[model samples]
Target: MNSFLAIIGRELRIGFADLHRVVTPISFFAVVLVLMPLGLGPSPQLLAKVAPGLVWVVALLAILISADRLFGDDMKEGSLPQLMTLSLALPWVVLAKMLAWWLMAMVPLAVIAPILGMMLGLSTEAAVITFLTLLIGGLGLCLVGGISAALTLSTGAGGALVALIALPLYVPILIFGSAAVEAASLGLAVKPYVLILLAFDFLAVPLAPVAAAAALRIAIDD
Candidate 1:
């Protein structure tokens, strides 16, 4: 228990120490949202219709872009091997790292998502739904992405491999998240989609760390 909290604190400190790691994803997220309207032309109706999907897609990409770095620094610095040898289980350590990554990467995106959604022409209700869905779905993204990051840690493939491995898994979250926002936009019940996103997180939270830990073991062994 002490070790787990220590790992989380250490990861958070490391993440904030390198502000680029924390800022890059959010910057990418904002830049893409800003440029998308220009590329698609300034049609409010069109933007409103596509805003849910666009926001979810861009957010997923931003997470993927940062996923490779999740384990990269630890692995390079020899901290990962040290972590694996700790008294606490590797899965717990992995979960701690994932929690830190979620705080650093996903939380910022979630906080700003509603603002960006409005800029994309989403109604106030839909923008609120976008924020809600992001908070739920982004944790699932971080967990699943952590698995890919662990699996590909020794590959030297970076974000390309992380995206390839994680994108197919990301489909469900993307679908449900976009659906929730869209339903909100149309004044429809978003409960079902929100529930589905919650289900994904429940499954991912416990399972993803174990899978990622196993991958980390394999990564270290090879």
Candidate 2:
């Protein structure tokens, strides 16, 4: 328990030390939302209709943009091998790092998602749902993306490869996340979609770290 908290603290410090890791995803998320109006033209009805999907898709991509770096710094600093040898379980360590990354990266995106959704013409109800979905669904994104990052850690692949590996896995989250907001926008019941997204996060929280830890071992051994 102490060790898990310590790992999370160390990761948070490292993440804060390098601002790019913290800033890039948020910037990408905001920039894309800002430009969307230009590309799609200023039609409130159209933007409102598509805001759910648009926010979700951009958030997914924003999370993916930084996903490859989840394990990059640890590997480069030779800390990954040492972490594996710790008294604490490697899955716990992986979970700690994922939590830290979610805090530094996903939280900011989730926080701003409602504002961006409104810019895209989402109603107050839909915007609130947008924020909720992104906050929960982003964890699923980080966990699944962490697995991809661990799998390709030794290959020195960039975000492109990470996205390639994780995109298919991301489909369900995107679907449910966007659907929730869309349902809210239409004044329909959003509980079902929100529940599904929560289910994904619940499953990912315990399982993803183990899968990622195994992948890390393989990457380390190779």
Candidate 3:
């Protein structure tokens, strides 16, 4: 457990050192959320109508862009192989790395969401709900992104390939998460939406590390 913590800390330190990649997508997460109002004009009805889809689209795109950095750096430096051989448990290592990756890429977007949400004319309640939904949904996004990252690491087209593969899977998250917010605005119950988000995340979280580790093994073997 201590080793896993240290490894997570070490990876986070490395991620900070590699801020150029991490920060840009986080920035885009904010930029894209704010783009719709500017592009389509800022009317409350329209913003409410499109906000969910727009948020989902931005979240998906941000995840896609950020996937390239997941295993690419470790694979380049041969650290992935070393991690694979360690007794600390490869799944834990993969989880730590994915969490670090999420912190670098997704957490920032959550923090900055309210500021961006205002541009879409979301009410205080709706903005908070949107942030919460994205928080949960983004975990699944990162987990799935980790898998895609591992799968495509060798191809060097990791970003594009990840987007192609992930987009279909991302649809449910986009639909449910955004639907949650849109539902909230109408005074409807959002528990169902939250539960669905959790179901998706629960499904992805466990499988992601295994899949990523498998991809890493393949990467090392090849």
* 11 Cα displacement, candidate 1 (Å): 1.3
- 66-100 in candidate 1: lDDT tens per residue? 89989998888999899877789999999999999
Counted clashes in each candidate structure: 0, 0, 0
For every candidate in turn, the CA RMSD to the true structure comes to 0.8, 0.8, 1.4
Of 1 and 3, the candidate ahead on lDDT is: 1
Write model 2 residue lDDT over 55-119, tens digit each, in one string.
Answer: 99999999998888889888889899998888999999999999999999988998899998998
TM-score of 2: 0.98
Model 1, residue 165: C-alpha shift (Å): 0.5
State how far residue 12 of model 1 sits from its true place (Å): 1.3
Superposition error at 70 for model 2 (Å):
0.5
Global lDDT of model 1: 0.94
Q: Is candidate 1 or candidate 3 better by TM-score?
A: 1
Better of 2 and 3 by lDDT: 2
